[model samples]
Target chain A: MPVLYGSYRSRATRNLWLAGEIGLELELRQVWQAYRLDKPDAPDAPFNTRSRGFLSLSPMGAIPVLVDGDLVLAESLAINLYLARRYGGDLGPRDEAENALMTQWTLFAATAMEGPGLAIQNVHTYGRADSEAGRGEIADKVEALGRPLRVLEGHLGRDGHMVGGRFTVADINVAEILRYAQSHEPLLAEYPAVDGWLRACQARPAFRAMWDRRAAEPMWL
Target chain B: MPVLYGSYRSRATRNLWLAGEIGLELELRQVWQAYRLDKPDAPDAPFNTRSRGFLSLSPMGAIPVLVDGDLVLAESLAINLYLARRYGGDLGPRDEAENALMTQWTLFAATAMEGPGLAIQNVHTYGRADSEAGRGEIADKVEALGRPLRVLEGHLGRDGHMVGGRFTVADINVAEILRYAQSHEPLLAEYPAVDGWLRACQARPAFRAMWDRRAAEPMWL
Candidate 1:
C-alpha cells in the first residue's frame, strides 16, 4: 500500500487520479496546514517545517509526495511516471519511440505549461488580480503560454492522444496541468484538438471521480 | 544518425556529451541567433514568432531539439534519456529500480537545478556582475539554490554517484547543470560530496573532450 500525503484540491488530485487508474490501495494523509508567508511560526502552516514525515519525504517541504514503504518519492510528474512504470500496464507506452514521446509531453507540461499555469493560479485562486504587479505578471505569462498551447494543439490535431493512440499517464499528467489553463484562460475555442483531447480525458470515469472528490473539498489557496 | 539543432555550448551540450559516451553520431545544426528578450527580428531567435523550425521542434521556441528522422524530441533531459535508452550499454541502468532512480534525478535536475543555474549563468556570463539588479538576482538565486544543493549533498553523501553508484545519463544530466553552478559560484566549498561528485563527472574522458570543444567555441550570450 502507498500513502499519499496532500489534500485533494491540491496537485495531489493528479496522484489520486493515478491511484484510481492503477487500482492501488492508497491511504490519503491530509496535512491540515496553512501557509502564511509572513508568519513563519503559524501552527496550521501549510508545508509546516515541523512535520517530520513531509520533511523526510520532501526536503523542500512541498506537496504530493508518495510514500511506498521505504521508497519515498516527491515531484508529481516523477510520481506519476513511477506509478505507471511499476504497475506494468497500458498506463505507459510499450514501444521505445512511444515512451520517448510520453516523456516529451510530460516534460513539456512541466517546463512550458507550468509557469503560466502557476501565474494564473496566483491571480485567480490567491486573489492577486488587483495588484499592478500581479496583472503584469499574468499578462506576461499569458503571452508566454500561447505558443506552447498552439504546439499542443498542432500535435493533438493529428493524434487523439498525446503519446499513443490510447490514454496513458502522459495524457493524465499533461491534462491535469491543462486544467489550470482551461479554468483561467477559457480560450479553448481556438484549439479544437486540445479541447477535444481534454474532453476525452475528462470523460474517464476515474478522472470524474477524482474531480468530484476535489470539488467537495474545501478550497485552499 | 540523429540531427541535434543548437550550438554545442548551449543546452545541447548534455546531448553532445551523451552522444560521445554512447558513440553515436549526431549531426549538429548551429542556430547562430542572439536571444533577444523582446525583439521580433533576431535570426534563428527561439521566441521569434516567425521561425517555423523552431516552433516545430519546440513549441515554446527553445533550442536543442533532437530529430531522429520524423520523430522529433525536445527537452534536453528527455532527449538525453531517449538517446541513452536507445543506444544502451552503460548509459541506462540494469534494473527497474535503478531506472526509476535515474528518471527521478533527471527530472530533479530539470525542475530543481536548471532555473537557479540559469540565473547564475546570466549573472556571470551575460548579465554584467556589476549591475545591481544582476548581482541581486544572482544573490537571491544562490540563496534559493541552497536547499537543492543540500539535497544533492545528502544524496552524494550516501552514494558516490547520482544513480546505480556508477555513471549513467542521470549523472550526465545533473553534472551539466552543476557545472554551471561550479563556474559561477566559487563559494561551493561547503558541499563536499556535491563538489566531489562534480569533479568526478568532469574527470570523465568524454566530458573532458566535450569541455575542450566548448572552450574552443566563441562565446554566445
Candidate 2:
C-alpha cells in the first residue's frame, strides 16, 4: 500500500489528487490531525525537526512524504511525478515531448510561483497588517508575483491545460500552487482563461472530494 | 539536432553536462559571445536578464532553457530529469526506491540549499567588503545555511552518495549548487565526505571539459 503522510490542507493535497487521477491505492495518513504546530502533546506532535519519523523520511523536516513499500519520497512535486510515471496511463503523458512540457510547467510552478504564492499566504495568514514594514514587504512580493501569474494567463489563453491538451502531473502541481493565489489575490477577474482553467481543475470530482474533506478545518498559517 | 542556447558559465552548464552524460548530440549556441551584461550593446542589457536565449524561452528571463526540436524546457533540474527519462539510461538510479531517494535529494538541493548558496554567491561576487550592512546580511544567511550543510554532511557520512551508492542526477544537481558554496566558504574543510564527493563529481572527464570551457569565458554577470 502506498502511504501518504501529511495534513489535508498541506501540499499532500497534490499527492492525494494525483493518486485519485492515477487510480492508485493510497492510504492517506494525516500527520497533523492531532497536533497543531502550536500544540505539543498531540499524537501528531512528532512532525517537527525533533521527530524521528520525519527526520528519517525528510532531513529537512517538511511534510507530504510518500511511502510506497520501501520507496520513501519527499518533495510533493517529485512525488507526483514519480507516482504518475510509475502508474503510467492517462495520469502520465503519452510521449516524450508532452512529458518534457509537463516537467517544464511543474518546475515553473515550483521555482517561479511558489516563492511569491507562499509569501501571499505568509503575509495574509501570519504577518501583522498594522506594521508598515511587514505589509510593505509582502505587498512588494505580491506585486512581483503578478508577472508569473500573467505568464500563466498567457499560456492558458494559448492552451486550455498547462501541458498537452489534457491533464497531467503539470496540472496537478501548478493548480495546487495557484489555489493559494485564488484565495489570496482573487485577481481572477483579470484572467478569464486562467479563471476558467482553475474552475475546470477544481470541478474534478477528486479535487472536490479533497476540498470537501478540508472544508471544516480552520485555515492556518 | 538539439541546440542549447546560452553561455557555458551560466546555468546552461547543467544542460551541457546533462548532454554529455546522456551522450546527446548538442550544438552549443553562443548568444553573448562578444558582449557582456555590462556592455552597452549586450542583448540582455536593457532588462539585465541572464541571457537573450534564456529570456526568449522564459519572458521573466532565467537560464538555462533546453530546446529540442519544437519542445523547449526551462529549469535546470527539470531539464535534467526530462533528458534522463527520455534518453533512457541510468543517469539516475534504476531501482524504484533509489529513484525516489534521488528525487528527494534533488528537491532538497533546490529548495533548501539554492537560496543560501546563491546568497553566498551574491556576497562573494557582488558585495563590497567595506559595506558593513551587506557583509552582516551575508554573514547571517551563511550562518543560517549551516543547518542544511550539517544535514548534507550527515547524509554523506552515512551514504557514499546522495541518492544511491553511485552517481545520479541527484548528485549532478546537488554538486552544482555546492560548487557555489566552495569559493565563499571552506566547505570542504568542514565536511570531508562532501569534499570527496564533490571532487569525484568534478573529476569526471565530461565535467572537466565543461569547466574548462566555462573557465575560458569572460565574466558576464
Candidate 3:
C-alpha cells in the first residue's frame, strides 16, 4: 500500500477521495501544516511541514506526499493522476487521447481556477465575508473567475463530463479545485451546467466518504 | 502532423522545443494573444485570442492550443506531456513510475513556480526593474521562489534528470518556466545545481532551434 502523509483536511482529501473511488488502500499518515501548531519545531510536536522528517520526504514542506515504493510524489492533482493511471480501472484514462484530455483538464484546474477559487473559498471559510474588505475581495475574485467558469460550463454542457463522458480522474481533479469555490452559491448558480456537474460529482459515494472523514478532522480554517 | 496554434513567443515554445528534439513536424498556426491588438474584435484584426475562430479552438481564449486529429488540448505543459508520450521516444516516460515522476515535476512547475517566476520575468521584461518599487516586488517574488528552487536543486542534484536519467518532456516543461526568471542572473546564482541544469537544458540544439525562431518574431514585451 502507498503511504500518504498529510491530514484529510488538506489537499490530501483529493487523493483519499480518488482512492475511495478505486477502492485502493493507502497508509494514511497524519501530517499537519506548521502554521496550525503553536510550536512546529517543539520536540513533542506532531509531524508537520516544518518537521525535519517530513522535509526529507518533501523539500517544499507541503502536504500530501505519496510514497509508493521507490517513488515519492507530491501535489494532490499529480498524485491522484498517478494513482488513477497506475491503479484505477474505469476511473483512469482509457487511451492516449483520454490521457491527454484528462491531463488538460487537470492542468486547467490547477492554473486557471485554483488561485481565484481558493481565494473565494477562503473568504467564506475564514468568515471574512462579514467584512467589507472581504466582500470586495470576493467580488473581484468572482469576476476574475467568470471566464474560466464559462469555459467549464461550455465543456460540461457539450461533453457532460471532463472526458470520455465518464467520471474519471479528470473530474476528480477538477471537482476538488472547484469545491473551494462551491461555497459561493450565487457565483456557482450563474453557471447552471457547472453547478449541475459539480453537484453530480460531489454526490458520488466516494466523495461523500472523503468529505465525512475531512469533517471529522479539526477545522483550522 | 499535429496542428499547433500560437506564436513562437508564447508558451507554445515549450511544445515546439520538444517537437524539435523528437523531429516531430507540427503544423504551426500563429495566433497572438488578444492584448497585443488595438481592437481584438475588429473584423480586420489578425487571428488573435479574441478572434472568433481562435476562441472556438480554445474557449479560455488562451494561446497554444494543440489539435492532434480529433483531440483539442490546451495548457502548454499538458500538451507537451501528451506529445511526448505520443511521438517522443526516450524523450517521454519509459514506464509507469517514470510517467508519475514526470507528471509530478510538471505539476510542481505549474503550481509552485510559474506565478512568481512569471511575475519576476515580467518585471525585467517590461523594464519595471528600473523603478524602486519594481525592484522591491522582484525581491519579494525572488524570496517566494527560493524554497521551490531549493527543492528543485535537490532533485536535480540527486537524479541529474527529471526521470529515467535522460532528457524528457519534464525537463523541457520545467526549463521553460525557469527560463522566465533566468534573466535575473544573481537570483539563479544562489542555486548552482538548478543553474547548471537549466544551462544544460537550454544548450541543447533543439532548444536553440526553437529559441532562434522565437527571437525572429516581433518583440511585444
What is the TM-score of each candidate's chain B when compared with the real chain B?
0.86, 0.83, 0.97
| Top DockQ model | 3
* Model 2 stretches astray by more than 4 angstroms: A33-35, A39-49, A186-189, A218-221, B32-60, B95-98, B187-189
lDDT of 1 by residue, B80-142 (tens): 888888885787867656666777777777777777887788787774777998878878878
Docking level of model 1 = medium
Write model 3 residue lDDT over A44-87, tens digit each, in one string.
99889999999988887999999999988888888999999999
The collision pairs in model 3 are none
DockQ of each: 0.53, 0.57, 0.84
Per-structure clash totals for the candidates: 2, 0, 0
Candidate 3, residue B147: the lDDT equals: 83
Each model's lDDT: 0.77, 0.74, 0.90
| Better candidate by TM-score, 1 or 3 | 3
Writing each residue's lDDT as its tens digit, candidate 2 over B53-72 gives 44666664555666887887
Better of 2 and 3 by TM-score: 3
Chain B of candidate 1 versus the native chain B: what TM-score? 0.86
